[model samples]
Target chain A: MSAPLFNLRGVAAIFSAEMARTRRTLLQSVVTPVLTTALYFVVFGSAIGSHMREVGGVAYGAFIVPGLIMLSLLTQSIANASIGIYFPKFTGTVYEILTAPLSAIEIVVGYVGAAAAKSIAIGLIILATAAFFTPLQIDYPAMMALFLVLTAVAFSLFGFIIGIWAKTFEQLNFVPALVITPLTFLGGAFYSIDMLPPFWRTVSLFNPVVYLVSGFRWSFHGAGDVSLTASLGFMTLVIALCLGLLVWIFRTGYRLKP
Target chain B: MPIISIAGVAKSYGSFTALHDIDLDIERGEIFALLGPNGAGKTTLISIVCGAVSMTRGAVRVDGADILRDYRATRRKIGLVPQEIALDIFSTVWNTVSFSRSLFGKPKDNAHIERLLRDLALWEKRDNKIIELSGGMKRRVMIAKALAHEPDILFLDEPTAGVDVELRRDMWGLVRRLRENGVTIILTTHYIEEAEEMADRVGFMKGGRLVLVEEKTALMRKLGKRRLVLTLAEPLAALPAELDGWHVELESGGSQISYAMSDGAEKGAAQIIQRLGEAGVHIKDMAMTESSLEQIFVDLVGAAAGSQP
Candidate 1:
């Protein structure tokens, strides 16, 4: 019998199961991030802005909107995707997926697709909440949406790698907690890297998150700390690297099969 | 033709071999039981065929489809009920079963899923989360999930381990029905009687090797032993010279004599009794028993272990 080139139904099954899990944990998945965004707006946007006043010709409160959104986007994307794959491995339910008639591409699409979708939803929610604190502007609405989607998909795939690599619960929470969060904070989510000394600015260029936040901010205000080309190049490079690593993982069955 | 065929299959973890070179074929619609002690590679073999574990060397074909080259086709044709109760605790029984059906590339078929739940006696608990169900119910849900996609072959790895007797009977009935519906069933179990009761053919694995495979009845006939035991009315210190030609052992402090009936020994029982009368030993009572599958399994495994270097 001729088999279909793709198992779309299997992909949809995994996607829907993951999405249903989000719905079941709505309070933790959605409400927690939204509330955390509200708190950040209250302290950093309103309270701190009263003293700093402005940054790079925009109100201090409005300047951090894109940064705030990017922070939540990066963290949530990783958390969602990591937990999505890791939970199954932890519970031993992943045998079903591994044994199913699904290709590696289909499995990735199902899991990473759901994770990206969820993070994007939370990003949009945070954007809506941020609007309550500062008037927003989108110089290139299409570009803003593109950057949002690319970042979510790229980081979600990265999170998928971490999920597979993690052997214990502590390891599962390690990268997002100790690595990604620190990088996002240092990537100029709160202020422009240009405002730093030339030495610090040079060191900041090594941080990949800087490009993501810069491109995202540039889409909102038509200006950023880095050139638009560099930002887009960095985002594409991250995506390519993540996809490459995933291909290797599935091919070797690293940490997934023994 | 065999629904599943294995050739030169082997698996190793570093220096340790989990499964030795194994070759076997399972016929269509037959209940084939794999009998072995712990660490005998039963689960490893199943995992290799089901694509859960990578094999060091070998090839397997399911329904004429090469397991590696045409894995999607092969996997779609088989359903596996793993030994562990692996499930999402938050997922309801309905969602779990339906999702499994869809995962195998089948389109939404609520009718089939509903019928499966009812047959497994899980319809009333369809809406309950997996964590809320009893262990027996969880096992039933696993069965429901495996059968959701209507596979042509089902691998039940230790299907009734730790299960109550009532549910074990229920599961046996269900398995028979599945076979009747033309689904080939393969199971690995420690319960020897399970194999004796349900398996048309039985394969014994020992120390990662396939040691024996035969029809259940034929295995019994070939290796089964019978024993005759007599209780003495008067204690005897030793057997007389007339019984020297027979294999008999004195036991119970000289109050009982046990005889092992070997090939062509059916007539020996009468001759031994006549000799006992002639030797002036009064017979009290006697009983005969046949070796059960459990005894045969132990002896086979024990003998295999003894021969290992």
Candidate 2:
């Protein structure tokens, strides 16, 4: 009698629209990031690889590849989802979405799902570009794919919340620029936390990006600063927290409905 | 049962109330025009019924389904043309309309979309992106998008505000045609003539409360006050003491005097004339005008405003 409650059409509509928007701004969303990752590989992989020896038992160029991919993945996942949701709010088109026959879950999945998918695709592209500078290997390919998806989905959900919380475009960029990017850089996207002093290594654990990058790095080389179990468990915990927050936002209509 | 039943629905944001005890039952296939000024809870009421804004108290049922429990059913049953231009500016008009239909879980029907675009005169601009369209064209795309889903009820909140005369007439014609097709159209408008021209029933809202709702003809017949304008032979310096009992005012450099008579036919006008004669007031010519919905609305709102300190 409920008539299959969930609406695939509604979800597909939103998903396709978001994906279409990503394609429309391919240069800014996909091409530019892939290019940026290529530049990073050139500076850190080829230029610096000449002088640097092997660290963590892997070549310097290859060691940083997973972390670099994680860096782009995290930032893009948040960026795509946050901007995806924020643009609707900015243009006032969010009213149409709010009024449509879509459940909050369906809407979230549509937007966040498309954003995660886009990030994963771009992340893979960056990894592919990195292969040109250095050799790459994945000891646990399935786990790598799994962690890639997990990180993308989790960060995209976080970005979705930012989209809802942000009142202005400047506010939308605040967390990504002033918070996430800085945290990712300090989180050991380019270097190992093991290289830091003992106190700094302990402090690095506090940055949430450390777990994400380390977890993702473990998937590639079977090694990380934090234990593999801890990284995986931490990501799952963060995903749960993000999901809980989203459910609350949708239920309370915080900054979404008046 | 009424198609849409707003039973004791009220909304308040923090300390300020937006809608207060608004209970309305809109019938099927009728053009219901809610007339109000800015911030009169017209948009609030519309938003609540659409489930875009949650009500702080009471409930709304669309087609007998509770809005809270059965939002999907209710949402699928109605199309809303918001007061603002709310469309994906990057998408083509055709894609926007088609996407709206899909959002309802309705199957793709190109024929239906083509027909809606044609009816709204958006057929030629079908492939054009919404950002490229002119203001009026964008409004037409909004209408086309709303109609794409084939909803049982259509809520148009200030659909023609700032629209050109030609588009307004076109919208009116489209509304009439939709009513003919048995779509329940509830529209909020500040334009009294639009209500007078289109609505079968008219409702007046003031200060977050619905003052009255009645059939347009019945309302005009019942509360339609008359104004008798008298062109005086000479401009009066001041109103005489005899003119104090009647609801009269001097205007146009005091050369014309207007009085609010009790009925549309001005039955009490004779008594007013007699009082004027007692004051030795000379009249050059006289004319009478019946109050339109605009005046009734103004009076209702004015009375409410007058009651507030």
Best by DockQ: 1
Please give the distance, in angstroms, between residue A134's alpha carbon in candidate 1 and its true position after superposition. 1.6
- What are the per-candidate TM-scores when only chain A is compared? 0.98, 0.97
Off by over 4 Å in 1: B231-235, B253-255, B274-284
Residue A126 in candidate 2, Cα distance off native in Å: 1.2
Clashing pairs in 1: none
- The CAPRI category of model 2 is medium
User: What DockQ number belongs to candidate 1?
Assistant: 0.83
DockQ of predictions, in order shown: 0.83, 0.59
Best-fitting candidate, scored by lDDT: 1
Q: What is the lDDT of residue B126 in candidate 1?
A: 94
TM-score of each model's B chain?
0.95, 0.85
Q: State the DockQ, from 0 to 1, for candidate 2.
A: 0.59
Which candidate achieves the best TM-score against the true structure?
A: 1
lDDT per residue as tens, model 1, B1-309:
799999999998989999999999999999999999999999999999999998899999998889999999999988999999999999999999999999999988999999999999999999999999999999999999999989999999999999999999999999999999999999999999999999999999999999999999889888998889999999889997879978999999999999998777879998998999999998899999888888989999999999889
